[model samples]
Target: MNSVQSLIQPQVLAQIGFAGIVALTLTGALIAVFPRNILYNILGLIVCLTGVAGIFVYLGSPFIALMELLIYVGAICISIIFAIMLSRPLHLSLPKRALPKVGLALGVGAAVFIMLSAIISRTEWQPAAMRSSDWSIATLGAYLLTRYNLVFEVISLVLLVAILGAIIIAGYARRSPS
Candidate 1:
């Protein structure tokens, strides 16, 4: 019983959970980028977003986590999947990767990674001076409906427009023979 208790310690469990979440995020990112299949890429993106939501929960922001899951994974990804399904046949082969473009992308990704690493290492991250006590879901909803309503509506409109544009473009592509 003592050994079992030691194995089940909170800190140990937390560390394991964090490691698993990080692995999930990395795996999803790799799947998203490396896959040639569009469906696989979307699935990977959903996995990555889910991992991010898990991270948010681990960081004590359940509201943001739930929003991530709902907005990104639930709404956006599903819409993308629908667009893909409506647009093209799953068995159609995509164009082969260009080596030069791949190299350029790698270079850019490395540069951005290095730049972000330097900035993160240099910056002094501090807590807010005045922490708000009213961080409940109800309060956040009220604020979104009241103060940030315009921004919220704008974002929704943008997403809708983007989705519509994708559908139109896909339809056009389908109509035009390669």
Candidate 2:
């Protein structure tokens, strides 16, 4: 066998990785959105986000992958957990939803999925004419502080506001009669 044939096949590995990601994404979505329990949903969201970070890593952007892990898994998920704990008592069971409402939600979600799939199937993605083969952490750091400084600032601001709001709301809920 040739040297190339003896080596691990990139395409096969890529396909397996893609399959794993897709499975994780679907499983997470089901657990997050379908479950009535808020805690399960949050945990599922974390799983989905982690899988997405893995996908980003596969796309040759380890910096983004790390950021994904940090921002989503570290910050957002922890905040959400804190919110859940502060707002709702674990002993209290949530009330069941009406069947009609559940059916309506399912219908809407299915329609959206079909529409999105069709759009994705029809779209033709094109690469830049002069695409550079430079995928570096230094370049990403420079761009984050330079080109995407506003976005970074906005995200930080948003996170700060969310934390403040969560604290206020939870405090109010605790004081007020529900």
RMSD list, candidates in order: 3.1, 3.5
Model 1: per-residue Cα lDDT over 1-178, one tens digit each: 9877876899878888989998999899889898888878999999999999999999888989999999999999998898777656753567689999999999999999999999999999999999877768898899889999999999999989987897788655557665
Q: Quantify how close model 1 is to the true structure by its C-alpha RMSD in Å.
A: 3.1
C-alpha lDDT of residue 86 in model 1: 65
Tell me how many residue pairs clash in candidate 2: 0
Where is the poorest 10-residue window by lDDT in model 2? 1-10
TM-score of 2: 0.80
The candidate scoring highest on TM-score is 1
Q: Candidate 2 lDDT, tens digit per residue, 31-143? A: 98877888888889998998999889888887888999999999989987986786568625766889999999999989999999999999997888898887878887898
Error of 1 at 113 (Å): 0.6
Q: What is each predicted model's overall lDDT from 0 to 1?
A: 0.88, 0.85
List, in order, the clash count of every candidate structure.
0, 0
